[model samples]
Target: MTQSCVARVTAAYRRIAEADRPEVWITLRPEADVLAEATALDARLAAGEPLPLAGVLVAVKDNIDVAGLPTTAACPAFAYTPEADAPAVRRLLDAGAVVLGKTNLDQFATGLVGTRSPYGPVRNALRPEKISGGSSSGSAVAVALGIADIALGTDTAGSGRVPAALNGIVGIKPTLGLVPTTGVVPAARSYDAVTVFARTLTEAQRAVGVMTGPDDGDPRSRAWPDDVRLAAPSRPRIAVPREEDLAPLSDGGRAAFAAAVKQVEAAGATTAVVDVSPLLLAARLLYDGALVAERYAAVGEFIAGDPSAADPTVAGIILGAAGLPAHALAADQERLDRYRAMARRALSGYDALLLPTTTGHPDIAEVLADPVAVNSRLGTYTNFVNLLDMAAVAVPAGEADGSPFGVSVVTRAFEDQPALDIAALLTGEQAPEPLPGCGVDLAVFGAHLSGQPLNHQLTDSGARYAGEVTTTAAYRLTALGTTPPKPGLVRVGPGGGAPIGGERWTLSPAALGHFIAALPAPMSLGRVELAEGRWVLGFQCDPDSAAGGTDITEHGGWRAYLEAAGEAATG
Candidate 1:
């Protein structure tokens, strides 16, 4: 039998308790209460209410308010319970997601190395000896460990993306103000973005989509522009930094990034190497220049009030902001504006920019030996993102010497879809197609499903999305042993079959022939029955393909299968 939401929550609790990574959480909800919330969600689903994130559990960064939970920012002296939920948390709750608890962070969201908290350094999810990357460390680890379906992290200076990259997960650092930061404790307020971390880009996208738009109390919050319609371009022009700019990368990191770049180029996108020295210089300003004053502006008073309670390194960095001359802040701001203009002109010709997420992955002991230096190194690729007001998605590119390697796809503010489109290409998933128009309705399964690896094949072939529909409980999905990991759908007898997830695309008659002619063995077009009793031409795999493949019928879809596989590896 399928697990109920309550059962999943209960099991997750047991796994978390056994995992015993105490440093990852500053405050956790009572197990009974969390299970009860899941039960309530299950009840709502049974009543036929529409909940996009029904029964999903999430972790809140300690810096954000969760109504009754303490917003500590991982600083014991700063802990406080809020009377109201953060606007972002409320949005997720309203979408049928439940909060598991508050995860730890760097003290007052001050550092990127994840070890500034009194709660103890956050250990990497896969490599315990390595730094988790912070100030959003715990939030990323919670999602990576499969303890949360989604987690919220604030990105002031790569806090969100860096952690996700280190932990091998998807981080959606939405455009500034797109997701309200009203209830968040500010860390350079102008640059702080409420980011979502999840195992897959689609999950992060869904959660983030719900949290976007204006929040009354947040002066920085704004609605997405009318012109920036959500969509993925069929073909994209991606920018890569010049070779010399990437010299800081470790050999393994460089090789992993090169492979990812090759994959993107093979997928039909054009890449151009451009000098980003000005952007790199701007990144230095985040810590080395007057921008550090913003940190002082946000938390200096707290450090001054109780100096002994602060982490030595975090306190030093914050306190150092005190003597910064006002003229320096103004000068750096002026300098940053120029850099932004330079970056805009540099990226104007491309849809998005692709870069290695981090230059290095340091171990916890190494970070402890030289906290500031190692932390600074971790932000080489991330620090410039929020300052430039761009949207970025960090996806796990591959592993490097037993550690996760990540690549970030960035685009100008509000043009998030193109970055995501390229991310799907890098990960071998299909980019979701735009809304449908006149054409023949054709059902699709496996990698061809919208937003899966091969969805671009349809969109590139001039197919338009018709709708998403599910199949009857007479089909099974299998994971074929293919190079890019495609799935095969097979019809089964009623007693053993299960409902399968799929999408419908509208393709012209002429396009359908070309699509089929290019399809490899074991996959062919055939009639498929929808759950609603309607029939449509769709993908089907030969029996021989399923003979040697793993039966993934339990996942109901390829996306779910991949997510499950990722979670299994984490355990």
Candidate 2:
């Protein structure tokens, strides 16, 4: 009642309804439910409780199961009461997040255009006549409208990212197995992933960290590597698709993408134009190849059982799936595997691949006129990600014609941290204030570490450099072989060690991705204990990669070593 964040947001929701209500949500939480959750969150905060997502209200795409809610997946006949929350939903709840209600999506998660839903197309939050990209339509609009801090969505193709791009929000689709897909209605199980949408990368990442991790029940869930730490490279190498590959982009989208590249370069990165045809081809296979059958497999029986209950558009798509022959499916699977290998090989040389989130933004009417064709076009860049086992984070670059423009940072699986880091850089969303009462401290070194060549990398990754800090005198510094000149400080022992240098930068997991991707070879990230007995993410040298590097521990820090080298040369 004292105007809590949740209350203010709820009130705003009502006001928007009174003004010019767009069909953003298919179903909303009852007033009683909203008030109860808000009261509980307020009490928890007042009691000084440890809540990771204190006062954060999140919306769930209707396709995802929320306990005590009906999951229609845009098809009312398919609606069912989920007695238990999905794995991802349960995690958010455990983190003290309040669920507002379920939002509209493309029926059965079959289309990228939000209009396919029987409940009514979700109009773009910025412009009501425009389509809100889907199948994560309502989730994106909810976040963009400030009705929720973050929203849960499913991205098989561009469901998660497309909506975010159209609505001007951050959409993060982690590695294929990074976030479990349990409890969400599957569109294409193998390609399906639970995604996060939020107004800020910081908020989005906070939700991701709380939701991610291997679940025993989910066969696809895998353990995260222990060595993986969210730290940026001294100089990141990002690959941009060649102009020819982006031919499908409208003039405005192309210009926005170019501007985003400039931003990445301005942040002290090297951008190399590369051909992305192979990736594009793989994306095409999602609908063209046997993968369509997978979509049918998920709900083919349900649709057949109750034809009247399904959305017409959804029925047509799934019906097409039924006709896919076994031989064709087999051939398609083989081709997909081949393409996946090629993608891995092509992406190995770059930290991450950057591309526009969508080639074009169609209005709701345009999408409705030709749903399948327009929806397929939207997924041109996104469909291949999960198939290739890649992680991606979509960040707002700028606006095009009053609509939002966004770029996706893609990397090989497990490199999710770096991709998010790079996205933060492009979006210029670094240094966000921490949630109230959260004591997590971040230490940055290198470009994002503070006062270094690529320092913007840190700020862009949403990291606030706490200050300079020294290692516990147990570290050795080496100038690893890198293009922009990088130093790796390794903790060797507890005694007889030098005061190895670095900065203390605190950031959420999403910010950490941008930082990690900027890391140059020979140097990698690791956990280093600070002199104050605090453990923070820091850099380490791949011992093998540092074999012939210079010992710069005598200089105490990377900056000092570089300065001394420059002076020696001048002399």
Candidate 3:
């Protein structure tokens, strides 16, 4: 049954109450006000009104104004109650999305580390000890925790994508000027973009679609081209950083990235190594050079009003920006233009560039010890993106060392679709299922899971990971005698089998046809009932094939079996 907006939102509020992650929000709307908004939307739906985002709840970064909510931007003394919603938030509200309230962020959106917020650092959604990449920390965490369906964050130097990566959610850094920023508190006016965080690229795009177009209130807003086309090239050419550029990554991060690259290649794209030194140099300019002066220019007066009112680190950075002379700022601008041109040329031959979203994940303690240095490392791959005027989406590649690992799909400005397309492939998230859309859910028990060998086949077919599940206790799992050892899930009569673990993925109708047709013998697509009480097309082994395989059902899953094999070999 399709759930109503109120039901979904009520559940979300309940979840938020249970989470008790106070740092994720700066100002939460009264529960009554939130329900009231949802009730209004429900009434509108009853009246036969069409609402694209009916009942959707969204969290806005405190830097972005929402009517009646104080815009703190993580600095209490700088708070103000904006009488109106930001242009971006207003549009979402008009589409039937409700305001959940204001989320915390790095003070003035100044630092990449979430710890810069006076309200307290926004902890990683999945790992309490890790830093939630920021200044959009709280907004991203809110979405990652299901507290909101969508969250608005500003990206000056990867504020949006960095946090999304750390929390295992989707971050869409739209083409600059495509989404108006008039109501948003600017970090670097010219480079600032209102970004979106969601669980899937499809949902993010839906929000972006409603928010796109020029707004008189925002001079920075630009009209999208009439002929703008969203697409995914069947044979995309992907660009990767040279090996030396990957030195900053931890071993797990490197392996996760390598796995992502292989998935794209298996999906039919070819990869090329590119020297991104120039791009890295441009990134350094964002914080290390005179470019930071823009942040000073945006909020310097407020800092001067009362230095103590600002976060010490944020104040320090802005104060330093005050020292950059006009000539140095000019020099940095000139260098930026040169880097943009070079990047344009470097990316011209490829459909998109794939980059590790961050060098490493650091815990709050580590960031607090040496704030600037650690924050700089996090932006090593992201800071150059906006300066180069590109569109990028960060999607979770998989888990690395128990934390989420993500990669960004980047392309020239306005080429946002290709990035989304690649993200969907890598992350296994299908495009938003508009009415009458054609797609199918395909469940897999082994090999096709993220980071697993042969997982690339699903990606190549443009499949998306929908969720995980265990079959009804009517299946037996066994290790096939294949050279690489694959799992075969065979159905047995009720009570004659044990529940087996697996992942469920979605694929477009066209991709599904191709995927099923290419399956080898002993493995075929058939129905499997999930513990959730829904049946989906999933991997089923031929009964005869199970005869020659060793029963390993006690391990519970393919991954578990593999872990046992490795342990036995090492032990």
Give me the displacement of residue 273 in model 3, in angstroms.
1.2
Return whichever of 2 and 3 wins on TM-score. Answer: 2
Model 1 steric clash pairs:
428-453, 429-452, 429-453, 430-452, 430-453
TM-score of 1: 0.77
**Residue by residue across 1-571, what tens digits does model 3's lDDT show?**
1678778778888999899899998998888878877787888999999888888789999999898889988888888999998889998999988888899999999888899987899999999999999999999999999888899999988998999898999999988998999888889998999999999887888888788778899887886443232445557889999889999998899999999999989877889999888888899999888999999998998898899989888899998888789999999999999999888787777889999998888999999999989999999999998898888999989978889999999888876766887777787666443211244778999878777887877766545566788988889998898755588999887888888899987666766677678888788999998888889999889989998999988988999999999999999
Q: Lowest-lDDT window of 10 residues in candidate 2?
A: 431-440
Candidate 1, residues 492-518, lDDT tens digits: the string is: 866568999889887656677777789
Question: 355-474 in candidate 2: lDDT tens per residue?
Answer: 999878888778778878888889989999988888888988788767888889988776677777778787676723332112235554444446667677655553444668887888
Q: Compute the lDDT for candidate 1.
A: 0.85
The per-prediction tally of clashing pairs is: 5, 25, 4
Report lDDT (CA) for all predictions: 0.85, 0.79, 0.86
Predicted structure 2: lDDT = 0.79
Where is model 1 more than 4 Å wrong at Cα? 432-571
Q: Which candidate, 1 or 3, has the higher TM-score?
A: 1
TM-score of predicted model 2?
0.80
